[model samples]
Target chain A: MKLLAITSCPNGIAHTYMAAESLRKAAEALGVEIKVETQGSIGVENEFTPEEIEQADGIIIAADKAVDKSRFTGKKLIVTGVQDGIHKAPELIKRFESGDVDAYQGDGKSINEVKQERKQKQNPFYRHLMNGVSYMIPFVAVGGLLIALSLAIGGHPTDSGLQIPKDSVWKQIMDVGSAGFTFMVPILAGFIAMSIADRPGLAPGMIGGYIAANGSFYGSEAGAGFLGGILAGFVAGYIAKWIKTWKVPSVIQPIMPILVIPLLASILVASLFIFIVGAPIASLMDWLTAFLNGMQGASSIILALILGAMISFDMGGPVNKVAFLFGASMIGQGNVHIMGAIAAAIAVPPLGMGLATLLNKRKYEKAEQEAGKAALAMGLVGITEGAIPFAAKDPLRVIPSIMAGSMVASTIAMLGNVGNNVPHGGPIVAVLGAISHPLMYFIGIIAGVIVTALVVNLFKKNVA
Target chain B: MKLTELMDKSLVDIDLNGSSKNEVLDEMIEKLDQSGALKSKRKFRKTIEKREKEGSTGIGFKVAIPHGKSKAVTSPKVAFGLSRTGVDWNSVDGEPARLVFMIAVPEESAGNEHLKILQMLSIKLMDEQFRTELLQVQTVDEAYELLDQIG
Candidate 1:
């Protein structure tokens, strides 16, 4: 029998040659002709001929270092350590004689590598989102807390809704808080893009994000909020990365990283937002607005479910804006029940997410755990945008969970005939005496929060 | 020009005083340094220790070959030692090693032929009769004479 063996060690000095010697001695004693390739300090000595490899019955790779087994794909292979080659040479040979070893497939595109690749690629989307989320939490906290505080301490209800008087210090605090909310989406996009494509992606992502958050850029009344920011971040990041790979002239290569790639990507993504995606979204909002107006005459239960889903779906996106507008318009017509249902639904997303973090700490990372704490406070004041970070990271799981909870809350509020004369929603509105049947409104919010927390925890996997 | 050129009477120890693997390494390194085969004793020792950390060079059948390739080496050389009582070397066979060969080669070696000769010495040590005859050597001169015939 003719066999082949390759021996290598990290040092490639002594054990490599020693192992080769031992394997050769064993082969001689076994009455078999074997070729031993020694990869040592002197480099590859006694390498196999292609003909010899083809003629071999089986091959043994005794190496402590990576031996590219790609060349021996269809051959029976035994891979072990250099130590095993020196000491267990006879046993390794015996395994071959006993017909124990299997043929190797070392091409990198095999099942194992594919599995490894999937594991590597899947987590990064969330990882990049987490970078954005971490940066965004402070803004949301400052905005939500400041707004809730100002509305609580310095505001009174009116026909127009909860408003702090124009010249008051509380109004300035509220404006400062509004400024924080304004920057939240753009910062989230910027950081997410930065994580994906490094520094070059930040400008394009933030600009794309700014355009997305402002509806007037697309001739719509309400802007796309957190969800649009996420889309813009991904689009801008990938465009920057793609531009980075271009085979540009050596003269332009110096300018490419700093000036060209960022400028080109930013313009491309912003143009895409204003010219393409925005038009369809604006029309969808108009249609949704008309559909909700039509749904006002339908069963209150169906209207309740639809409003709940729209509010929780994008949190503050155009669909949510349409629902909020529909409810606000209803209040002027003395049909305050729809607004009450919408209000109950609005608070569910954030409160549910807050409760979810408390219910299972293992499912969220350190940053998210802290965000969850902040989310509870936002939820109390009825800021549905508080749940945006969690949903953006794992939308497939979180969005559905929050939607189900909001539907239940809105439906409960509708059945209890809860009426909110205010345009705003949440426990704060009910507490401020703007909502009829305050006890029932609280029950609806509580129920929705419970549903959101339990369902989201059930769907989400433990933080890796 | 030959394997015998890398060896001398000073590089042989028929009866090693060292009872442990590290002590024996130091004892042999001292012999190599004294023989003027190393430019720096500390650097060569570092290379040898780094190699040992990869996996102990104490292979089976009571044999160990500690080796290094470093800029610290002046010329290629092997220091041979025989322990009357085996030193515990953490061998693959779990047997205490009685035979030790420490080889030192220059990092940018100009002689590939000399390296081939060292490889021959490595292979020659695996022979059962050669190992038995090695242990039976009575003096450093006798050990040198036997090793001189290897390559």
Candidate 2:
């Protein structure tokens, strides 16, 4: 009759709280005594006391990432995904009532070993992708800001482009920034493979990504970039996984993951990138760049629309990453216009949501109004992930509203011939002198924010 | 203040005879009326009904906490009732309410005292052991003793 539950997600934000709320409601309806502990972005809340745990009939751990189960030893425990806690709380409780769960055994294994046991229940693709993205974001943010800072303080604008003086401290700063960018692809690929096949996939994935990014390995002038890095990651991950399944001698089993798997996966992923995937992708990249360069006023507007839609679609998802990588690669090729439009689009979601709350306070709850202030601060810093809380709560209204706002901004920036010299976006970058025609860029952002606020407010009903 | 100070023995109904949520609300308010906590039964009932319209006060766990701040109340008071059969209050969890706590506060003292009492009651209600003990109480004094543990 008594139960204890814990809910957590990778981001430890929306999903964690949602699952906990769902479980509590379900337990109430079921006429059961339950205590729910939530491990979220803010940290632990409503934690279970030792007496409560001792008196509890069972425990449920619904989390995407690892949760320590050693404390629950000898207790009836069900380990599952966070979604199951949200949507299938009653069923899980029934399973517990039916005595279907295994008693927790305090096996002295690492957290990864516990994680591997639960991995089979989740979709590997989504789990791997999210794992990769979480690791990749810090690199992009740090590199982008450092480069913008270097250009702002040390570079002199010329007919060719912004130029940093040789033999200066600023040039050294720029080099460090570039070094961060150089490792970005490899780290992304490395983590993705690690998510798929554990630590064994790390070496092969990094090596394959390096080969994909360097032009000398393949017969192409411009290296394949992040797109190739993604392909290399998948290839390395699967190859490592396949090698892991092989029935090697008992004596070699311990060393297989460290040596055999990595050695074979590296060879396989490298060969595929060099001989097959690299040249085609490079040519495709060249053709796409050429096409973008040839676009006139109307065609360029359409391209901007596509980029804007992609950027806002999932906020910081793979679609957004694709658009970001495209703009970043163009920066290396001395093309800044594409990045300029994207830069304007990047702040639209968080800025628009914030503005919407301010425009019509009646339409949002007290918590949402607080989130609005945080969103505005994040938007100023060019962190699109700020809008994620709003989107996660009400995707239908927020997604379309943000995408519309971003599209309008992108169109205005493209039309005005706005150009961003750096890989980053937002007004902060522009204020740092990373952008040209900063006045027009500001106008575009303001226009987009107003449109989004008005439209979203019109659609949303007054909150209780 | 502790719950024992505000709650009257006359206002504690150990076995409530009500099949519906409206009937239950009326039964609990009549107790508070007998205790001289409520000035006008009809006016206070209307106040409670209006508050319920905003949202159900059913805090789940087979408990309904209906409260209102009005001129009908001379002072802040709490009335406890137990409906063993349970009455539907349209709770968030879709469960019928069995234990009911009807709170009445004078409009002059409503701002701070009303919220303070609700916060104090809800926090204690979150403890399953306290609820279990309260549910098993067979006498008015026994029920008062359990609620007295809450500040």
DockQ of each: 0.13, 0.01
Compared with the true structure, all predictions reach lDDT values of 0.86, 0.75
Worst 10 residues of 1 chain A by lDDT: A111-120
Tell me what TM-score chain B of candidate 2 gets against the true chain B.
Answer: 0.92
lDDT of 1 by residue, A1-464 (tens): 88999999876766788789899989989988889999976678897766676788999999999897766767899999988888788999988899999988767555444444445345778778878888988888788778777877887887677888998999999999889889889999988888888888999889889998998998888777888899899999999988876655444755776788789989998898899988989899989988988887789999999999999999899989899989999999999999999999999999999999999999887878887887887787778888888887788999999999999999999999999999988888888889999888889999999999999999987754
Candidate 2, residue A179: the lDDT equals: 80
List chain A TM-scores, every candidate, in order: 0.76, 0.54
CAPRI level of candidate 1: incorrect
Cα lDDT tens digits for candidate 2, A1-464: 99999998654534565567668878988888889887754457787655676688999999877887765767789999876786688998888778898878767754344444444324566456556655655555455456656766776654334568898798988788678667767876788788887888999998997887776787765566565666677789988978876755444755787888899899999999888976775576566556554553447789898888877876654457567777777777887888889989998888898898898898886767766776676677566755655664455677888899999998899889999977666787787677999988988888888878887887787653
Off by over 4 Å in 2: A1-121, A221-227, A250-254, A297-300, A303-406, A414-438, A446-464, B1-151
